[model samples]
Target: MSKVMKGLLLVLAIALIAVPASANLVATSFGFPVIVQSGTTSAFNQDTAFASDFETLDIDFPVFGDGFELGATAGVVAADGVALTGTANVLPFGPVNLAFPSISQTVEQTQEVTHTDFAQTNEQAEFAYPFVGVGPVALPGFGFGW
Candidate 1:
């Protein structure tokens, strides 16, 4: 082979062997240290009882920014409660799944919450929708969404 070709092959051989050795597969889990704690919301109420037999799951992540999120919640949360009728993006927590309103129409719902109950003000874990212009006052319902 030519002198240049032989030199090129030798360089290639050294690079192939050295690359993997020097460049160890480096994978580091990067996340801000966050203290895990159960979040709660104060009592909230609605005019009429809208959500019953609801499945509210709160999902908290390890990161947050101005009106944004970086990753999914630390884990799947399975909590249930009643809240107002609106988008799910208004809740105080990170990401929440309110599996109510019967996504599947096949399931038969025998009972509905009556106006007498009206979903009285109650404390729910990680689910609350505060009324605008009200200071720290949350109205009853599984609200907050994106």
Candidate 2:
């Protein structure tokens, strides 16, 4: 048609030829929490004790004849205790994306353990003997020995 119109058409054709065409549209977004926690807690305690005691006595007397007396005593005690504990192990993950259509994954884990033990023992022993007289005659007395 006119000179101005021809020049405009030629410039428009050149611009179209220079630009490259895109067939696919892609968009990406990412967000994560600022805090991440991971830790372990443990504790242990123990207690123990021991004790023992012993006593003994012996006596002899003559009352219008012959008499005898004796006594003995013993004791023992013991105790033991133990304890163990684990609070927890915490692990947390914000988010993970593997591929195409925005796949998200979250993971968390926690664990705890506790244990206790106790033991005790006690023992005791005692012995005694009585005196006897028959018509001014003394009789032998018997008692536990060892």
Candidate 3:
């Protein structure tokens, strides 16, 4: 592995161990995509597998005002293929060796998440507003008169 990949892996490990449970989490994923097969014209027979590592940090906290909330999240993922070992059979060659190529990738991302809602209270009297004319008779109001 290169220096950058090693450093990233180290950082991910440390973040997973040091961060709090509510803030950070680390996950490992494995997949068996290829299955061994024995048939005509098939040269290699092996069980292929893929593995990846991921780290996530998420926070949901209060904002500057009521009914307004804010959130933020950051994550990193690294994927690479694992080693494959099995037997190989060919038509002409009979039994032969098999080795499959693999690749690796690392991704890091951050996002801002937030939610805000403007809601009215149950008190209908708070919106009541009425105006009176200069004369003794009161003018008809257009606001909530309840």
Candidate 4:
């Protein structure tokens, strides 16, 4: 994998671990889409819209929780494959951070990820051309404790 992809995966993994719920969490996103069209470019200019709904769920078992856990779910949808995603982690310092006062605080940090993608079918309705595209992600820096 590219260094950037590796870094992103690392950051995501850290985000899951940094949050506290008396346990640890591992998460992934599941995407599903629906498309509708008249097979004509003119239809879009006249007035048209398409819809898709997708959701991501976080599932985990805490090492200290005796392998039991609570799950977290987030979702989003858009017209023509555009989407925005956001997630928050609330952390309680508890005994661990309390011992080290400098790190003790109850705060919520939120991360947002946005992406837009699209593809097209040819006259033969063949899913070819790959319709090349690009997606971008703007993630905010970490939010500290209160």
Candidate 5:
């Protein structure tokens, strides 16, 4: 080949080697509503009811070294003369790197109507550091929530 052609080929080869492999990224969202009930009986002539609305969104980009996840739920439960309504959410932040070992954090919250006609709320957070080994070997590192 001519010198100019040879130089062009060499540059192309080096560029291909320098570029990183493509990584898969995903993003999606969905919502669902559900209702469940049990059959009534003569002895226990009361029916239980449950209804909920749930929504979730997931975005993953491990190659870029970041990800996000969110889920929320609002529901109601009633039996006999008692009814309770509640809402909950799961939110996460930080890197979601699957190829390399990394740490992630998550926060959760829940609010409910108690039997005493009072609304109560609870919050929690957690951190996890996972060890990603070769092939299929992986160790789920320690995590604590409070």
Candidate 6:
């Protein structure tokens, strides 16, 4: 074997040997929006009331800017009070789904959110941020928790 080939193999072996058993993604800048909304013109009448909320989840690495997720909440108090759930793949930078007055669909939905009687703001929006590096020295994860 050539001297260069032997050296390369040796380096690879040492790197592999030093790598941790557990591996995880490393994040750079981490952020997500916990959007809240209320008060519209009409929700089918005074008898019927509706409220919708939205939140986004993102994981960012140095190379990739943002990965996206959309979660929402909806409630209707017409003849009977009802709640619905749904979700969708959203744009990392913006809300992926939207509703417009099309005069076509009656029950319009953007996404679904878990029902929280009292919705909390985005406190841990940037949690689980991972740390970086290549082989022998890479931080695990950060943001809030590591």
Candidate No. with top lDDT: 5
| Residue clash pairs of candidate 2 | none
Each candidate's lDDT (Cα)?
A: 0.43, 0.41, 0.42, 0.41, 0.46, 0.44
Model 6 has an lDDT value of: 0.44
- The collision pairs in model 6 are 72-112, 72-113, 86-112, 129-142, 130-141
lDDT of 6 by residue, 1-146 (tens): 99999999999999999998986865444334344544434223123345665544443221232443232223233444655443322224454434222122234346444432433333222333345544455555532464
lDDT of 5 by residue, 88-143 (tens): 33223355312222234454545443232333445454443443333344333322
Give the count of colliding residue pairs in each prediction.
12, 0, 0, 0, 0, 5
Write the number of the candidate with greater lDDT, choosing between 3 and 5.
5
Alpha-carbon lDDT of model 4: 0.41
TM-score of each: 0.18, 0.17, 0.20, 0.16, 0.18, 0.16
Judging by TM-score, tell me the better candidate of 2 and 3. Answer: 3
- Against the hidden true structure, what lDDT does model 3 obtain? 0.42
The local distance difference test score of model 2 is 0.41
* Candidate 6 vs. true structure, TM-score: 0.16
Model number with the top TM-score: 3
lDDT of 5: 0.46
Clashes of 1: 12
Q: What RMSD does each model have against the real structure?
A: 43.1, 54.9, 52.4, 49.0, 44.6, 39.2
Q: In candidate 5, how many clashes are counted?
A: 0
lDDT of each residue in 45-104, candidate 2, tens digit only: 554544444444332211112333121112222346544432221222246222212123
CA lDDT of 103 in candidate 3?
A: 27
> Candidate 4: where is the Cα deviation over 4 Å?
1-103, 125-146
